[model samples]
Target: MDRYCRRAGALALAVTAATATGALAQDYVIGVAVANSGGLAPFSQPAYDGFKFCVDEMNASGGIAGKHPIRLEVRDTRSEISEAVKFAQEFVDIGVNFIVAPPDGDPTMAMGQITSPAQIPTMTFAGTAPILTSVGEYVFGSYPADNQQAAVLGAYAAELGYKTAFLLKSPDAAYTQFGPAYFGTVFEANGGQVVGEASFTMNQPDFSAIVTTIQALNPPPDVIMTSAWEPDFPAFIKALRGAGVTIPVMGADVLDTPTVRGLGEVVEGVVHTSGGYPDPGSAHAEFNARFEAATGKVADTNYVVNGCDILGMIDAAVQAAGTTDAAAVGQALAALPETEGIMSSYTFAGTDRMPMRSVVLARIEGGEKVIIRREMADPATMPAP
Candidate 1:
């Protein structure tokens, strides 16, 4: 089956229950709060689908540790802070063993306000903001920290011989703000300079003004970098390309969605960081194949693997703790040794709650995602979160 069709099939299934093949064991209830029909839906939906797929697979294999089944209690936040908080409160009231928070910073923070105090181990599948972990010791971020992603792209830009850059900043979230700043920091350390910068907001209808601003520069920058995603990214790229600004653009992993890729020729040559490549024989490839076979659909977004990795991390933490106690699991998660996941091998880097993993540099070539390189960024060189 095609990717979209397979995704639809998988998403159509109940998020609450998974079919198991053996006698049930002590089941772990995981509360999931994600945006299903809002701006965050593009990423969260696929991630939730991957989460569900993992749960189903685990249950079929006799659940976590081959003895405990997983019960998913899901609620769509609709991309609203109030809704996210409401669902989080509901989960806390019911005392779910763990929580899978929405991927966005605001919603995740709102959810954390509830989950953290209740001492539940809450994981945000793609919340890259470093501050998200500060909500409490119970909160953990599943994706690489934003600064790590920016540093990777920044050093990459310098290595590609880009001497000057024009940054496109965004005030919509910390991911956009700190991401670009760290990019500039690393770029400058490598003999590059940020010649200029412009601020943008999310869902801005027109990027012509930004495009014109870039065009107005006496000598265009060697590269353009941003932490923009979704509507902003597509609209900006369209405007940038339409205005004939062919400078290479660099971004973080959020740009690896179908929306940007669907732009095809317009997004060609744009490079960004990602999780891992699902090459034919690798673990990622096997997981992707399993997802397709189980759902009879293909995963549309690479973020699907983020979901699988979230569960993988949880399973490892649970095993390490030897119990499902939230506090113990949280500690185990932070102390987890380097572990393999569908997307990449990840570690909490010794209690930061940010997974230290290899960054996959990818580019859009001929309207398809192509790998440029994969390397672990040196923490010593990364800007402070």
Candidate 2:
């Protein structure tokens, strides 16, 4: 059975049955608008599942602060911004206390335009663009900003004694556009050189010209870096390797998808920043075990923990504020102390809505992901968004 199909029925009962009987008085009515089918589904589905998993655990533990049971209403946005907006407006009309938004920025932003003015705190599980916070105070992002991921990867590459780097940037989104430049800035600051730069549109059919350009460099760069995701990334890597280019490649969290894992040996030694890795004994590993027990499926990506972390923070904020008033809850969320989340230790204390969290760097070897290290990016090196 589809896990979401089963959970959807239970969610309806939890939302309506308890209130109809007056059995749960202090309930947190939360709205979820995540894509279950569409281009964003690969990332959003697991994240939505994680949110539901956390909701199940919290309600089983007697809910937030042991008294307030959560009532969830979920809608599939199908990766469309219009659907996201419509559902967000419905959530506002029904006066939901909080919202879990879609995975990508455009939908999240559209939802925020509705929810923020209505004073509903909205959190996006995978929208990492730093500017998402500009939507309003009610909006928050669970993933690290693009610059943060770039800083971590670039700093790690320099630490590995890579003296020269080449960047392959994409014009598809802010994530691709800014991430490569930010990486270059940090790499140069660390005494490394950016030997060359190139740009490609998302899903570009050919990389032969780019590969030739890299090969023709007077002294080849020690490593290649990029922030492209999905089909584009895999295609680029395959073309580079197929053309006999052997330079190591480093990237941001965009590489943390199931598609990349399918590359197997092609991705060996590829380094990238991630939300978190489920190494044994880690909090993420523990959560994954529970997730499997609860859903009968293993998480395919670290994005699962991104949703869990967002909900956990919401729980903490609701408890701390002692009420679900949007202003109070929003303030509490922004003021949360560093929390040990399934993803990592995160806090929103000093900035907009972006979480300051440790970045996990991982390498693929033998068709498995191995953690290289976890570190906080240098705030001084974080490029301006």
Candidate 3:
């Protein structure tokens, strides 16, 4: 009986040791809440692919600090504001250490409340300036601010000698409203006149009414600027051409997509402002390559770049913190300098959680969105008035 008791005790101890070893090798889960499986799914999928590629590479490389393997817990927010809030709550409940969001200002704004309280550092890929800086130190944005794009668009329009410009946008989307509104304001402030301003609904397939309004503006504006989505651009351009309005059409970063390239001649003269260039040889070349391989498509837009940079930023923060602790990660992210990323080098400026002031202007030339100018907001080139 004494010998049997000793063997049983030894077996129990070995089981506990094996269980503890398995627990020690478990990975740290990072939650990604984007507009996957929704209207923006096409764009978000590429972003998610970029993020996954990053996480896969990290895990293959022995992960952060060589202690924990990284795992992603992705949630599809459906591009709805309420769904985003629910996903954020779910992420909090799951005790996820990191969160990534899509390029929707409203959704990110809703998520800020949950993440801020949980003290989890978030990286948003949206261009919404208000929501981005509003989240305080808890959130950082990989995409350039909406207002920065406005400044770049204004400068590009002025350079093209567009003395009279007409602004058209979708009233429902923050991107549609804020982008054109701010661009118009900056353009007008820079000695250009906004001759006509118009709004449309996102679901509106026909832009005949808006095009008619634009065309009826006595001496038609030299340029017609819009903040429409990629899918809507081709149709809107066709409507404009059908309405016999042949002025140069310009837009925001929404025009920088593979779908836009399919528009061919319709998008030829259009110029748009973006933070990233589509060329694979650009800053995020390897990232783009990985994303393309995973998705069976090229990373030819800002969404993928945003995802790559967000993950890259998180990787840097984890390395800096030396652990996956949320608060420590936030502090490490805040302390990050201008590190070169797959998109651009982001430097935290003062108390602002937004990226450093760098913007690039891209124009559709010969059926491709080509980089025209790269500008950094410095003492000489201050943030737009």
Specify the highest-lDDT model's number.
Answer: 1
Answer with 1 or 2, whichever has the higher lDDT.
1
Q: What is the C-alpha lDDT profile of model 1 across 262-282, one tens digit per residue?
A: 897889899988877887798
Off by more than 4 A, model 2? 1-22
Query: How do all models score by TM-score?
Result: 0.92, 0.89, 0.88
Clash list (residue pairs), candidate 1: 6-297
lDDT of 3 by residue, 1-385 (tens): 9999999999989888976765456577788886767667776777776777667777777765555788788878888878888888898898888888767766776787788779988777654554454865687777777677777788778878889989887778777877787888778878999988888877687888888888788898999888888567777898888777789988876677878877777777778777776455665677677677776877777777677677778878888888889888988888888888777778764536777746778777787767787876442232432
Between candidates 1 and 3, the one scoring higher on TM-score is 1
**Residue pairs in steric clash, candidate 3?**
none
Separate clash counts for every candidate? 1, 0, 0
Q: What tens digits encode model 2's per-residue C-alpha lDDT throughout 127-182? A: 88877878888899888887788788888889999999999987767678778889
